[model samples]
Target chain A: MSAAAARADAGTAVARVRGLRKSYGDREVVAGVDLELFAGECFGLLGPNGAGKTTTLKLCLGLVEPDGGSIDLFGYDLPRQAREARQRVGVVPQVDSLDPDFTVSENLLVFGRYFGLSDAQVKARIPDLLEFANLSGRGDAKIQALSGGMKRRLTLARALVNDPDLVILDEPTTGLDPQARHVIWDRLKQLTAQGKTLLLTTHFMEEAERLCTRLSVLDQGRVIATGEPRALIAEHIEPQVVEVYGDGVDEWASAHAAPLSERCERTGETVFCYAHDAGPLVASLAAWPGLRHLHRPANLEDLFLKLTGREMRD
Target chain B: MAADAQSRRTVARASPWRLPAFSLRALHVWRRNFLVWRKLAIPSMLGNFADPAFYMLALGYGLGGLLPAVDGLPYIAFLAAGTICYSTMNTATFEALYSAFSRMHVQRTWDAILNAPLSLDDIVTGEALWAATKSLFSGVAILVVVWLLGLADSWRVLWLVPLALLVGLCFASLGLIVTALAPSYDFFMYYFTLVVTPMMLVCGVFFPVAQLPDWLQSVSSVLPLTHAVAIARPLLAGEVPGQVLLHVAVLAGYGLVAFHIALVLARRRLLR
Candidate 1:
């Protein structure tokens, strides 16, 4: 929130979606969703599987018609004037779409044509864009030869071929290694630094906390919570977390339940104690010498788990 | 705004058949296919040309030597005319069904293109036209071979260029309709068997429609390929094709109507 806080003059919303609804057969995927993205800020949609994140993203791109809603993107109606609104928007879909038939540079060049850019215009930008993706000299490399990370980076570069104002990514780093994930995060940060608006969806809470200025946690196609990341964490969870686990941690938790911490949760062999401060929680750990404990500040993952149930969907 | 949105959705759900916008942007989609095909053009074009050449030469020389002249023309010459129509139809239909489906479903090329500023209308039209373009190439190659084989040296053959395009359009459009409805590559077998193969046999590609059973002759009259062969057979014989407008109208009608249906079904398939 602090890194990309809204300035005093920030007024115009880049995209405004209200009461969007969509259903497939008898199953309602997106029940009622609303989203508003302001200029030069990264907003995230955090949801578990089947939480309607991809469907919502598709609706914003005008790739799918909403069953019922109003979408005004760049001040134009959607799925109708979607062509015009999409003129200045770049999208990276949930699945990678870098054409395997073409080389890296060819993919970028051909995609630019779809946006009405001439070959010369796209060619001129290919070097810079490839460099941005850290694929400086692999322009002629086949898409089939590139690794997963390279394809992801190329997809990002291809999206920028039009130099779009708003970039929409659906789980940009879902299946990447840690290093690859960091590279994408760095590239996205550069985009934000250049004052580009980003609206993305991710189940990775840390990614949301690091990249999103504001986020909405979606459950069952509904927004359960929407606010600044740290602010939401502060509102929903205690400021500190103490994890205690050892041979007799369960017995120690019951003995010191009321007097020690505000709330506690036991999952598997770990007992998570939540409190406003770590001072008393840490000091209380001395009584149970057989127990091992660790104290740290609360994070967005804690808030997310608190809001969305901890049960595994499958 | 809500009312307007509702009305628009209602309109979309009610009727999807609007006149082709013929948006110039569809050429970008055509260009995409062109760029990809350019890589394999040499081998691909050869395959398209060779398939028909083998069939025509084998059937004409081998089978014609066994039978009397078909309609006062050498069997090879008669088969050559029908071969042009059948070859063009097969090329366009194959490109539309298999190649187009790969880009749409497997390669996800159309999904990538959809993220661009272009609409679904542009993608369908572009793919259908690209398939037609492939057939045109196939038609041209066969035409040149027919000329070399001493079938007809008349200027009348020049008119077949546009006819090839029309036949290509009709079959390509019909093929795209099947593509939109297909769930996988295996689904194309039914189209080839039920639609393409039947049309080839009864549409006078190998023999005259008059030889068909009375019921089939009536059915072949309505088939687009019959008109293509009808015009082509007369053109290869150096004669003015009878009912030129009616034949052209039939082929064009099939192309235009099938194109609209493909557009409609694809909107349901992809846009969902």
Candidate 2:
């Protein structure tokens, strides 16, 4: 579904932004953007580095004041009523903001107090929170003692202490290994199952495809496109892609360049051939015996690359 | 959407002074700091006590024989009151500058707190108050030592507790203002040397400010430590402090103004 269609289907919106704009000096970071996050669905904001994804997330949380825009979260106006809105919201920032001085459990306990939870209330929730994060027995361990994955899980678990109606995660699984990433993904899924709205930003296309029900692709401080992962691929890109590259691959590509697909991308030693049908491309690739190729269905990564371009942002 | 558009139109005209919106929620930030401080309470207390102890040994007794009585009191007795004031300023200033910076920037603790219902004002106020509370430990430690050693001339010395807290708030607020402007740990050297060291010498910590030149005395009179020492010294000597209300008002003025400025600067630095 597109962002608008998804909004129409959603029962109630957790947040809405209209014509959001933010700038740092001469450069416009987030320029004329609109977004809506609904309850019980995972919304993704995908962009390359410096695409203003982080700025957009901060704007929603009232951390960064927008140059020209307004945000309403749970019916409370941003900044003016930011404190009231934030009472029901949880945020796991892009960086590790966990307190190093406190133990793992102490981190949760202290953070709970920020939302005005009493000591007894915080303690009552500690066991369940620690268990959810898979750090049940490690509560007393200092933050430094926990591994990177453990710290990330603790950060996620910390965000849940308030039982927030909405959770905003910025690059939730950026540095984790596959196993740790899968665990976080499962926990996030559980949150959605419990009816919590999730808004996340990620450069990892696979992460977005796996978790996000609907997402907006941002580039150069604008939303270029917004839709479901598979729907976006089917609508914006070819149905198939054959990654062809190896020794003499460039020479062969140049020779049969006329019959090859019109939409092709060359990055270093590899050439990506995009087409509605892969049969002709596969048969033609058989001529280059020594070359290597893999044909697969087009995915969100292809649509993202096509929409945002393949250039490195930073 | 229409309501949102209406709010957006008014946002451009919002007052900049809204940056420091203080609330009672600051107590939570203070409690957070207290919970963390309790983990290393022993080392924390020892560190707070070390400076006052050293000053008493090195300056109070070491120079007692060479320096004559200050304002008709023994050198050690006079030095004790100044030590409490100076220690309060030092403890509060150091805590606000170094530890508060670590929480705000390095550790990103302020960011974490801001994620919740708290605002920048709550965090800054909590930090300033926590620093003052921490400084109280050092002030009280020295007060106890002086009392035991017979350095306190009268029961009026008890007033030093509240005086220490006032002095602590004054310096802590000043230090937080510096923390708001500091870009890195190395930036603190300028604050300690140019601001803190000068206040220490001119505020009559070791020697009477009355001995300084007429113009220097006027300069010292404006310093927060001077007011702290003025009230503290008279109380320690068993004499009623003259112009007590003015001295407190000056200290309070520094604290209130510095606190307001710290909140404003911190909001600008952290929020955008």
Candidate 3:
């Protein structure tokens, strides 16, 4: 789409970026890009490391200035009107920036006060906020005492102290366990149900699939593809995948498996067989002795690999 | 959307100076540090008191006996007024340098504050004011010791409270300026050894600025600590100050300029 057309379409967007670009010295970190985040939708920016997902999120928050382009967040220009836009926004940065000096409850109290909430008002909300984070009894505990998951949860709760309309999370569950991840996802779902808009960045395809209603896949500072998780999978990849692995899969692919599958890809010892129908591929794999294979429908991960290429991005 | 437009218009109408953009929300940042300091009150007080107390006894009484009285007061008493100013400078500078650096970089406290409605100006001003307040604690503590030990000559010594706060602002601003440029903790040592140590000696903290050579005296007159001691010494001795307005103006000038510069540098460092 033309840049002006894209911006015109973003009139109802919570955040709109047109031809956004940022560079550091000789390297362009975020090249020309356009994005529009609608109200009350869970939008995801999915990419591997160095794909500029963090930079894009920072640009949206007005934390970093773009080299070129215009960003209108909540109908206000960024950096210039950042303080105003940020009043209705909450952020959970990729790094842990929680104050360790105060007890868990004090962290919330002080954070709320930053948004101009009075001491009485902040104190009144502490109980509900702590309860929401599942940290009810641990309010008196120091930050040092909380587990990683608990700290992440408290960070989330801290973000909500302002009762923001938009919550931006950068890799919210990057280092979290599965149980903790699920709890966060549930809380995020509740927020969306309450008509809160969410913008999250993650490399985990499963996370994007489960949480985001619409997503943009980024690679090397550009948006490679943008759509709903299932739609992107349906558009870019075959319906089924057969993973054939164990001893001599390379030799088997050259002699037998190559003719049976629509497309084949090898990364190390494993060979992924892509097809519209996995039934035929799975049946063909049964004839090969001692070959272990599994068949399933293609997911967002497959589509991501197809769009961004299968090369490992450090 | 109307609210956003209103705020945007307010921002557009804001003065180019940007210094006055600080908000009362900075008090929240100050209150946060106060709460944290309360937990370590005893140890913090002790650390603030110990250095000046050691200088008072070791250099005041121990070395005073061998030296002549200074400006009609005993050497120890002369040293006492200097110690008050010195202690204030140390407290504010240390708080702004080591403690503030850790909060800004290591602990990421500044980042948390910035995520809210607070601006960079608010956070920087909050830190500077908090450092000044903390310095007051040490300055007042030492003032009490000076009074108890008979080093203070008159009730005018009470004026040291505001003077100490001003000294705190001066050094805090200077220290924060360094912090904005510092890449690591190791960068602070250059400031301590080169700037602070030299200021302590030539700024009339250890002896009268008049006692120094003519060229050195010229340099001493420009130092913020010199003005602090000039005002604080006479207050300790219950005498009227000479060049009071000039001394205050110079100190305030250092504070205001350094504060503006620090805010600009910090905004560049943290926001980008």
Candidate 3 residue lDDT tens string, B32-127: 889889999998888888778888979988889998888877888899889999999999999999999999999999988888877778888889
lDDT of 3 by residue, A147-248 (tens): 998999999999999888789999999999999999999999987776778999998888999999999998888888988899889888989998889877
Q: Could you give candidate 1's per-residue lDDT for residues A133-185 as a string of tens digits?
A: 99999999999999889999999999999998889999999899999999999
- Candidate 3 similarity to native, TM-score: 0.93
Question: Which parts of model 2 are misplaced by more than 4 Å?
Answer: A1-10, B1-10, B13-16
Q: What tens digits encode model 2's per-residue C-alpha lDDT throughout A66-108?
A: 7787888999988678899999988988899999999998999
Candidate 2 local Cα displacement, residue B227, angstroms: 1.1
List per-candidate RMSD values in Å: 3.1, 3.1, 5.3
Model 1 per-residue lDDT tens digits across residues B1-272: 33344423432432456666679899999998999889999988977889899999999999999989888889999999999999999999999999999999999999999999988899999998899999999998999999999897899998989888889989999999999999999999999999899999999999888897899899998889999999999899899999999999999999999999999898889887
Model 3's C-alpha root-mean-square deviation from the true structure amounts to 5.3
**Per-candidate chain B TM:** 0.94, 0.94, 0.92
Q: List the residue pairs that clash in candidate 3.
A: none
